[model samples]
Target: MHREKALDAGLHPEKIRVEADPYVPIAAARREILEGIVTQLRARGRVPRVCRYALAVGGQEPRHSLDAAAAFAVRQSWRIGVGQSYTDHHGAAESLTRPGWCLVRQQIRAGYADGVVVVTHSVVSPHIDAYKQQLNWFGAHFGFVALVVPEMQEWRP
Candidate 1:
């Protein structure tokens, strides 16, 4: 559908490669988030500091998604010392409240990362209120901010 729209809009297929999957968007979002993080850090007077990353996405195939996200983060000059993905088949709460999040939090508290990069806000919850609440909770408890790529916003601690 998107490829067809691009073609209809006079975009040459040879000039664009389109994949009918979520990975492409996820990867793009990852790059954008990492770059945004770098900019934010620089603005805060942090000079060329290596950033460790934790990747959490909610889906059946989180491994593939996290791999793509991590690759893009590395390309964007993120160190990515820690990375993890969770399958949200059971529920967003189940995944969000699990050990993975705790481990990520631990890493941040231990001075491993400046913040976490979430692929999308929906990874926390589909509902807007829940998403914001969870972001706030993580920020408050972990003392680290989250960059929600899809929303292009940072949920601060």
Candidate 2:
């Protein structure tokens, strides 16, 4: 009904893609296309113009984690932007009140990166809602989160 109404109202048919709606509760076609691009990038090697982000929560050492994330980026064929790596030691807040996180947002805002590579989603947030919120924020900024370690069987696809 709504689709017919939209067409009757002079909306272009191509402009009303129901499957592309974010609130549709299904994997959007656009997302599938993006995943395909990521896969192609991996096949080629060294996808340029990405960034790295790490959170050293609960007193975990940051260097090793960052290196691992960097390796993950390489394996995914992403070339992280120079000086675009960010880190936050204490990850105990939902508000994301950390200097390094703030910097990452800045980089995202400035359109310098497509997304960030992280060790895990838990580095973004331990709670589910908070984790989703962070991802949503990244989406809002036209960026995304790439996890090196998928906790359990949770993969990006």
Candidate 3:
């Protein structure tokens, strides 16, 4: 099914609150979370690990934003597995579900990390429920990290 169809058929979009603060910045929370995830992924190995993070940002400037984010991480000496896949105007994938799943799976494998952290620019949560299903299926087929979205307080380990 097309992304729009899948979403219209009942996919929950991403929900993020864009907090306003003079001391803080937009996407600051997201950047912090991404960096933290990258650090944790790096710590999993005895030696320096190749840390990669994916941002599934929709809209016109995904490449620009993703590149800047990746560059920031790279400056900190991360391996940085990066890629961008554009969604339709309705946040739907023009491609098939299988292909989308494959893209995510390939990225996960290439990163060789235990956990996957997904962030988005849209205030609305995007493709996570659907993405989680795909991740769960991929995990079953490959025996990877048992992906779980923990309760807010429980997310910190």
Error in Å for residue 8 of model 3? 31
Candidate 1: worst-modelled 10 consecutive residues by lDDT: 47-56
Taking the tens digit of each residue's C-alpha lDDT, what string does model 2 give over 1-157? Answer: 7778677658564554543323223223224433654665557773545677777767775887789888987886677877978877764465378777778778878977767777766677766666667767776766667767654434433
Q: What TM-score does model 2 achieve against the real structure?
A: 0.64
Q: In lDDT terms, how accurate is model 1?
A: 0.50
Against the hidden reference, what TM-scores do the models get? Answer: 0.47, 0.64, 0.35
Point to the candidate with the largest lDDT. 2
Order of the predicted models by lDDT, top scorer first:
2, 1, 3
Which regions in candidate 2 have their CA more than 4 angstroms from the true location? 1-48, 57-61, 154-157
Off by over 4 Å in 3: 1-61, 81-90, 94-101, 110-128, 131-157
After TM-score superposition, the amount by which residue 71's alpha carbon in candidate 3 deviates from its true location, in angstroms, is 3.4
Candidate 1 lDDT, 77-150, residue by residue in tens: 55555333323342535335656565656665675665555556555455555555555554454333334365
Select the stronger candidate by TM-score from 1 and 2. 2
**lDDT, candidate 2, at 30:** 25
lDDT of 1 at 76: 53
Compared with the true structure, all predictions reach lDDT values of: 0.50, 0.66, 0.38
